[model samples]
Every structure is written in C-alpha cells, then in structure tokens.
Target: MRTLVFLGLLAGFGFGQGPQATLPNLVPQVVSPPDFPPELAELEGLHDAGRYREVYEKALARKDAWGYVLASYAATNYARYQASDKERQDWFRRAADAAREAVKLAPGQKGTPSLNASVEAKAYFALGQALGRYVQYAGLFTQALLVNQIRSAFSKAIELAPDFPDPKIGMALWHAEGVARNICLIFGCRRDQVQVFLNAAEAQRSNSKRVILGYVDGGYANLLINDLKEAERGLTTALSLTPKTAEDYYEQERAKGLMEELKRRKGGSR
Candidate 1:
C-alpha cells in the first residue's frame, strides 16, 4: 500500500477545477470477527509463497464472504507486482470485482450491525488499495476520475471499522500524497491529516507486519509532507521492528533506502 502511494505520487495527476465538497463524517461501529478458520491458514501460506494466482483461485472456490475478501486481497497484490501493464490492469479489474462480490456476500447495509461487516470492511480496503495502485498507471484523466473512488472506498472502510489500522494507513497516504501533489488542497485538505491517521494506525500495531507498515507508511507520508525530522523518526522506528515475513523484510529495506535519501537531503541542506 505504501509502495502504491509513493508511486502514485510520482505519477501525479491533474487536479479538478474548484473546491469539492468535504467527505462526510461517518461514525465507526465496533465489530469483532469470529474464531479463526482453518482455511485462512492455507490462504496465508499461498500468499507468503507469492502464489497469488493460486490464492485467488482457491479463495473463490470457498464460496464465502471471507473467501471473496481473500481473493480481492491476493489479486490486488498480484496486480501491484505484475510486470506487464495489461496483466496488471486485468488483475486489478478482477480484484475490484471480487471485492464487490465480497461486499454483496456480507450481510447488512453500510451502518448496520451485521455479522459479516468486518469482512465487508476488509473487502473495501482491498478495493481501495487496488484502485490506489491502478491510478498510478492510469492516464491523467483516468487518475483524476478514480481519485474520488479511492477516497470513498477507504473512507467507507474506516467508517465501518475505525479501529482497523490498514484503512487508516491508506487514508493517511491519500491525504499526505494529495497534499504533496496539491491535488486535494481545494477539497479542504490544507491541514495535516496524515499524522492523525498514521498515529491511529500506530496505536493499533499489534503484529510485526502492522508495526513495520505503520512506521514505513508514516515515514513515507512525512517525507511527502517535507517533515524531515518526523520522516527520520518513522523510518528509524520501522527499521528497529523485527521483520516476521518476506513482505516485512521488503518494507524494511525500502525504509532503509528512504532513510539514506533523507540523510543525503539533510547533508545537502546543511
């Protein structure tokens, strides 16, 4: 997700003409998941192996809400790492479709207390993450068009599960990158929204991945905002966290590179 955010900022899009309406303040409802199912272990195994195609295939075979969410998640990552533009677009499209299916499978409306709301929230997160990546490679007009959808999906996920850190991280990237690019400034984004969401995500970092991502993404956001001190603090914290997976290690290396860049900038500034 941080990778997508950084790349998206580098591939900047054109801004719209005027101040847009503010996003609604949707209240989050507390919800909990049931006991962990055995199928998720298999999904995790496939994901860790980078067999996203197989993960998506197996997840769809489960014919359940969580299965659809897993498919979306896997497909999104697949698209993110794809080497071919056509293949990446196809996978992202599939990811969006699977995520919508997951939302449909999950019971209840937007604000209702349904048993499947948590899965629904996860589905939205996947959709937002995928769309965020898609915009990076899309045309300038397409990027402008999809920006609202990206914001809407992440905002809905946050509204559904405010305590969930991933969506907050996504939101922080949205605000930070948007501000850096001057794309969302007219939409009431002059204030520092990145730290607010990044702090929320950091507060809920319960696992190695979450802890690592919180710092990596927080540091990335700070870098965009030109807060060198905060960016250094965040990347430093990220490197200190123990990496428990390949993805975590990848982020650790990325953070290290960012730290090097920051040091060069600091030295140049002196």
Candidate 2:
C-alpha cells in the first residue's frame, strides 16, 4: 500500500497535470512526497540527466490533451528555474488552469474534490512563492502585495490541510519578513516583526525541523527574549542534528545568518 501510494504521487510528475509550462523555482530535491510513482526511476533517469525538459515535451507533444496539460502542470518547477521572472508566473498560471480542469477527469466526490483541492492549493502556494521570488529578482519593490499574497496562500494551505506543516510557508514567512523590514526601513516601522515571523517559523518546526542557516535561527530566537543561553543551546542543538545533505543546509544557513545578525546587533548596542 505504501509502495502504491508512492507510485501514485510520482506518476503525476510533481503536482498538477497539463500541456507545457514553467517552474516556480529549483524544486528542492529533498522534499519529495512519501508516495512516489513506479516509473519514477524511468522519469528520474531522464530528469537526473537534465533531459526532463525534453522528456516532458515528448510526453505532451502528441496532443492538446489531458496528459499533455498534466505534464505541463507537473513540469512547472523545471520551467520556473529555466525562465525569467516574468515567465515564472506564466508557468504557475498554466498549472492553475490545468488543475482546475483535473476536477472533471477525477472520479466522484472522492477523487474530484481531492484532486481539485490539492491542485488548487498547491497552485496558490506556488503562485505565492513565485511572487516572493519576483519581488526579490524582478525589482518589483512591492513588498506589501507580496507579503499579503504569501500570508493568504499559507492561510489557504492550512485551511486545506490543517495537519500539514508546510515548509514553503516557513520559508515564505522568513522571506516576507525580510521584505517587510527592508521596505519599511524608510518609514521606520517596527523591526521586531521580523523576529516575530522568524519565531513563528522556529516554533512551527524546531523539534522536527533543521536549521537552514546552521545556527542562526536558534541563536536569534533564543536571544530575542534575552535567552542567550537558550539561543546558544538551540543553535548548538541544530549544529549537532543538522543533516549533512539535502535541504537541511537552508536551515543551517538560516541559523548561521541569525547568529551573525545577533552579534552585529550586540556590537551596535554596545
């Protein structure tokens, strides 16, 4: 049953289904679903060799059909990394369209709502994440809208699946806080909100999560309430538990960066 579930997930590619589109970003290789596809080895053979784009096109090249649409939807991550900022949203929009269509192809209430909701939920989340990237890369200077969108997407994700501990939202909140701080620098808004968001991130994942920045999140979170000892404790824990491979690096780096920030602030305070 587990193997069947894994196969089911991998068969769809990444998420949705459709023609041909773009990606949101480099889909971190670490976050694969529990249930993957049987032919994953085959598809992976193509993707790992950097032929995923070619294979994707070939799979969908034959017709303007459902599978084709689905393929595009699944391949959005690839497209996101390959395209310019303006083009990334195109990929997500395409996935959203394709996912909306998947409702019809699915079985009765069971499959239909599940497929459609999952599709839409992810599309919305990806759309938000891509927009976050756009603000940073495209020189949009629109932190207000970007943060709002990100918060909305995360709220929707929780609404869809309250049990989910979405890492994307964790990362998004971090980025959103950064944007807010930078954008509000002129107006002299509260800087503490940045720490607030980061704390929420840590609280959400500290036990089961890794420090993307090495020791910074722990360093800062522990220090924020004047918990320097606890901060060091948490960060030190992260350093020991941190994975040597995969997405753990992001957390490691995050912790490292936060510690640096703390030191800088301490120096400034002195």
List lDDT for all candidates, in order. Answer: 0.67, 0.41
Q: Which regions in candidate 1 have their CA more than 4 angstroms from the true location?
A: 1-38, 81-87, 108-117, 207-209
- Per-residue lDDT of model 1, residues 1-270, tens digit only: 854654455465321111112122322211122211344765655565456688799998877777887788778766644325568767877887888887788665232222223777877887887777667657755676677787898899889877677888888888877888765634345437888888888876652234675688788888878889989999999899765543455567678778987998889889
lDDT of 2 by residue, 1-270 (tens): 854543332221111111132222443232223111323334433443334455455535433333333344345534443445556555555543443343333222221121223433443444444443333322223444444554565556556544334433334344334443343342222345434545554554532222443244435434544545556666666656735322344345455555675667667767
Error of 2 at 227 (Å): 9.2
TM-score of 1: 0.77
* Per-prediction TM-score: 0.77, 0.45
Which residue pairs clash within candidate 1?
none
Global Cα RMSD, each model: 10.2, 13.4
lDDT of model 2, residue 260? 71
C-alpha lDDT (0 to 100) for residue 194 of candidate 2: 39
Give the Å shift of residue 173 in candidate 1: 0.2
lDDT assessment of candidate 1: 0.67
